[model samples]
Target: MIVETSPENFQVWVHSSRALSLEEKRMWLERMRSDPAAHPKNRWGRCPGFRNTKEKHRSPTGRFPLARLIWIDWDSQADIPLLVPESKPSLLSHPSRRGSVCHPADPCRYHFKKDNESTTDFAYALSLARRGFSDDQIRQRILSERTDWSNHKGEKESKTTSIAPSVVSNR
Candidate 1:
């Protein structure tokens, strides 16, 4: 099922054969490019008739965008087993051992570099900012997706805020 919470923004839900664990759900959310901070089981989807109250989503005519159902498939089921990650990602990190997961023509360069995660996170945040993501969106992505940022609350907030100046100057 897919719900449009605002223009060009959607939340997707998959009905699977078995219930997924918290970590499993997190992985699925990451794969779907969802805000990981909102991936908790207790998180509720926008109600169909409610307005998306975010200031940026407000229409020019002084109204907010309405959240609505985009699509649904009650009869369809997600393949649960395919969603699970391999037990050892390091085995696949090496280019030769990547098999078919990481295409030979286009390999994922960010695969197993835990030591440089902070640098990578900063670069990722910069990319998002360059692509016109709002400050809040960049903050959420940094907090949720960056391993280094998650461990340092004060530092994370400040770092996200600092991205705005760089974004403006670069443009």
Candidate 2:
């Protein structure tokens, strides 16, 4: 769930090519090729999807970087994880143990995975939501989902108690 809050300078750098030099253009392309959030194709799509440099280097596998996993829960999720494709991230001042669940603004190096056996990224969780899996099923797959993050901090719904929203919703 990449909520791009790119500053004006970054926006200009991304949308306008006239102000950049040849070297700058090369570097920007390299950056975009390596990073998906800034990649125009990813931004062009309606759903949040995996973006990385895998398509631009290491033999240029013929797949669009934006063609990866799709995450459409960006609008509703209380928190969305952010992953930077850069080799060296800058926002690691306070890294969270939950790698993929980092604050979207805080840059973190998230190793995105496709398998369901071990990997647990919010995007993958959103994928499960898109696939029609129940919230409990997702919770079983990812324990961090225990908190009802959709509600306010003080109004959080607890799953263990009788006041759990799932039970309430059932009623």
**Per-candidate clash tally:** 0, 0
Candidate 1 residues lying further than 4 Å off, grouped into runs, are 82-171
Candidate 1: residue 61 lDDT (0-100): 97
The positional error of residue 83 in candidate 2, measured at the CA in angstroms, is: 44
lDDT, candidate 1, residue 42?
91
lDDT of 1 by residue, 18-135 (tens): 8888888888778778785776679888977799999998778999988889899999887787565668656543443212343234212253234566666665555555545567
Off by over 4 Å in 2: 1-120, 144-171
Q: Highest TM-score, which number?
A: 1
| Prediction RMSDs, each to the true structure | 18.4, 21.7
For residue 5, what is the lDDT in candidate 2?
21
Give the whole-model CA lDDT for all candidates, comma-separated.
0.66, 0.37
For model 2, what is the error of residue 115's alpha carbon versus the real structure, in angstroms, after optimal superposition?
17
Candidate 2 global TM-score:
0.17
